[model samples]
Target: MNGDAVRVLTYNVRRDVASDGEFDWAARRDAVASTLRFHRPDVIGLQEPLAHQYADVRDALPAYEWVGQSRNADDGDGEFCPVGYRRDRFERVDAGTFWLSPTPEEPGSVGWDAAYPRIATWVRLEYRRSGERLLYANTHLDHESARARAEGAELLRERVQEQRENDEALVVGGDLNCLAGDEPHRALAGPDEESPLVDAREASPHPPHGPSTTRTDFEGLLPDRQIDHVFVAGCDVAGYGVAADVMGDGWFPSDHLPVVVDLEL
Candidate 1:
């Protein structure tokens, strides 16, 4: 929206878990902080974020503002998706989350067939430069439930469509846990039956050197399969690419790599 294009990133930090067999929570925290510092994204959608982890990032980047609710309503201390952005560049207008089930009223309720509670955080942000406004929604789809993933995709599509009708630039980003060719991706991208509602995954160019944006911790080998993405609607994407920070120091800050995009309002 501003004369300066906004840079956005989406990452899933894997609940600060590391495969190195060394459970140094402090090191994990530092890794997360360093990753953010390296990219310096204007806005970030982080999945599997804990309150403590959020605090670390907030303290490290004092200028950024964030919002999100726990995945579980019971304070079970589990993972959740938290969205953060640089306040000086964008002003938050509204923010909230809804359940991924048929009865979406329950804020933190676990959806049917979902392995864990799923939530989508939505925020309305105003770009300071051009005085343009946009809506962003971030979430992690149910990793193990096919039904839940399909339904979640549909729900997100509907929400984005509603927001687009208001003539606002829209972008959705997150670690969807589904491949670019999956059903969930297709559903959100507007399955063949309707006009494409969203442009996701391959909508942007990927880093040239990394194995996709996701990797398994098996013996530290990097494999291919991009599960993280930045989706956009009602906006023009000027430039986009994935951040290959994982290739540094023989260690990955998280299981999933962060994706960044530059947009023109």
Candidate 2:
């Protein structure tokens, strides 16, 4: 890293249209575009990226190079995780997706108690500043399964350990659906010699009950949970924060706020 740090962001854009039925598809697209433009992260990890949704984001930000893989075992529509990066800032060295199952090879495979298929998308990015490389992994955990969440966390740890053999920085981010001080977070925060994962949420600017990382507008001011997170390893994280895009019109870019982090490779 030419002595300059890189900024990374993770956002889980709700795939469905608004429940209020006020904003059309175009409005939703524009909202997302505006949010991304305002943040301008070096690398972005997005969840619930459908085919059309991915195209919309790409069209809005043409300068970004992107890659995505479906999580549905049946290969049907629904939700998928997609990652995008600034073409000039980072070069993709490698990328792939694996199911959150004991036997991950079987595509569209379902894991224990998982309501739907789950996957983790990983990419090796080379930072232009210092010529340093880092591995990034993004995923959305199953909302309904305890076993899936625990196993998924272990799987991610194993995957990161394997990738660390390459001697690169590591970062993992997504809507884990697990709260602070949970088992899943504990698994990712385990000790390691080369790269120990650290939770960026705990290091955020907001204090408890100030500005939460996520808010469910489904009900009137529903109980908030810090489900979304960003974890870093093998890199020096300068700072991190959650983007509260709640506008005066009571509209947000997504249900979950985007988490941003500045890191030195």
Candidate 3:
């Protein structure tokens, strides 16, 4: 990697569920780690992982450290959206989580017309090599409610605007459950001039690699459901891709493919 470049990956690991059968976490844990290891991301944002599931990945990637909390509990008991970074390369300045609701500070608060409570995890890090700081956030939006997703996007935008210091580079990523032209995407990366971020894929000079869509459903991939994305500010997108890696058994690591972006900060 170049001195100014950092690779970021956004993935939805799909919470451990027995109903997943052959694709269960116990069966694919190593595959998930292998995929991540192969990509060698400097920073990662993961969605839909329970505590145990996150722990499994954490164990495999010894170089990474993370910050996250469950959407349902302050003690980290439920599903989580976690942001992780290379500990040897970056020193964490601060970290926290906030619910995607009207009462953002209230843990487990449900927002809008959503069926489930959602949250975003964030971290402020200083790159050890360059001494540059970055504010990175990760989230999972409600799949069942358009209103919830749109409002959640606005809340994230507001928080990013409020917390950013001296225009330090910003990166926010997750399973937004919306397409490129969707309201939530528009809210974050707008045709309007005031948007704080832009889609990394759109900013890259080279075309994206791998499949156009990001969801695989374990059984097969869909053509139009590219819900995973990374948005950035004050950086240049050097490369972007959708990773469709699989284990030797031919099973994908999770239901959703990982989205990767190489950024020059």
Candidate 4:
């Protein structure tokens, strides 16, 4: 019998605070919603989602239920690294949030020369059709701190290994802020690391055929680095690509196009 297939999208919906000029959140919110509605991924890992952005997208796609909190931890005030899953396809079994700092249990914490507070959100999902469970971890690494990124990779590696110890399927996706071959990427991709995580783009049988750059400067230029990624540990990767859709007054949905991957679980 064939295993169930799941579609995933990792997106950094540009925060509203930034002075985005013509491509502000207000202008692109609908386009982003429209894009999600069209894609309808079974699972979505999102970064930099301000509170309102989350609400707007949730309103647009009611079929999805999300679990996440701001990295700040006081409330849903700061940027969020959230995961959303289709309600009809999977059931949330467990969930939690951890700051990407020395004090991982604490909120709004910084680590290893990090400029901003960062955190990761994770959930355990049970596929209803097959009764198979998987661990999904979503995070956004610091943009400026190389040490934080590398250290954060180790932290996530531990999480992935934990899932492996349990013999569970797992996926990690988000905006790492470091491109392919960077220190953080190297740390996560190390073949010698405890059960090295495979890049979904590289593992996908279909291969990456679209733009390589996920972080475009709102101009859709081929960036020097493809910072956004989806890493998997226990699944059959089917397809992967950078979702680059130009809409809404000729501007794309987000500054960073989403990284979408299909997996057989």
lDDT of each: 0.74, 0.78, 0.92, 0.84
Write one digit per residue (lDDT tens) for candidate 3, span 1-265: 9796899999999999999898899988988899999999999999998889989989999999989889995557889998889998899999999999999999999999899899999999999989899899999999999999999999998998799999999999999999998999999998787787999989989999999999987867878899999999988899999998877756678999999999888
Q: How would the candidate models be sorted by lDDT, starting from the highest?
A: 3, 4, 2, 1
**Model 2 Cα shift for residue 257 (angstroms):** 0.7
The CA lDDT at 4 in model 2 is 57
lDDT of 2: 0.78
Pairs of residues clashing in candidate 4:
none
What's the C-alpha lDDT at position 238 in model 2? 75
Model 2, 1-265: lDDT tens digits are: 3365888889887775656365435556778788888988988999986778878898999989987678876653668888899989888888888888887777888877899888888888887766789889999998988888988888887877787746578889998889867878788875534337888655445442225646545222335677888888777777777777655466776667778887777
Query: Which scores better on lDDT, 1 or 2?
Result: 2
Model 1 regions lying over 4 Å from their true place: 1-4, 17-20, 193-196, 205-210, 216-221, 246-248
Candidate 4's C-alpha runs over 4 A off are 1-3, 163-165
User: Model 2: what TM-score?
Assistant: 0.89
Looking at candidate 3, what is the lDDT of residue 149? 99
Pairs in clash, predicted candidate 2: 1-129, 1-130, 2-129, 2-130, 73-108
Model 1 worst lDDT run, 10 consecutive residues = 200-209
Candidate 1, residues 1-265, lDDT tens digits: the string is 4575778888887775555455334656677788888878888898887777777777887879988877787653677678888988898888887767776668567776899888888888888876788788888999899888888888877766665536787888877778776888887775575534456444544433345546545225456667877778767676666666643466766666777787767
Using lDDT as the measure, the top candidate is 3
Ranking by TM-score: 3, 4, 2, 1
TM-score of 1: 0.89
lDDT (C-alpha) at residue 115 in model 4: 87
Q: List the residue pairs that clash in candidate 3.
A: none
Best by TM-score: 3
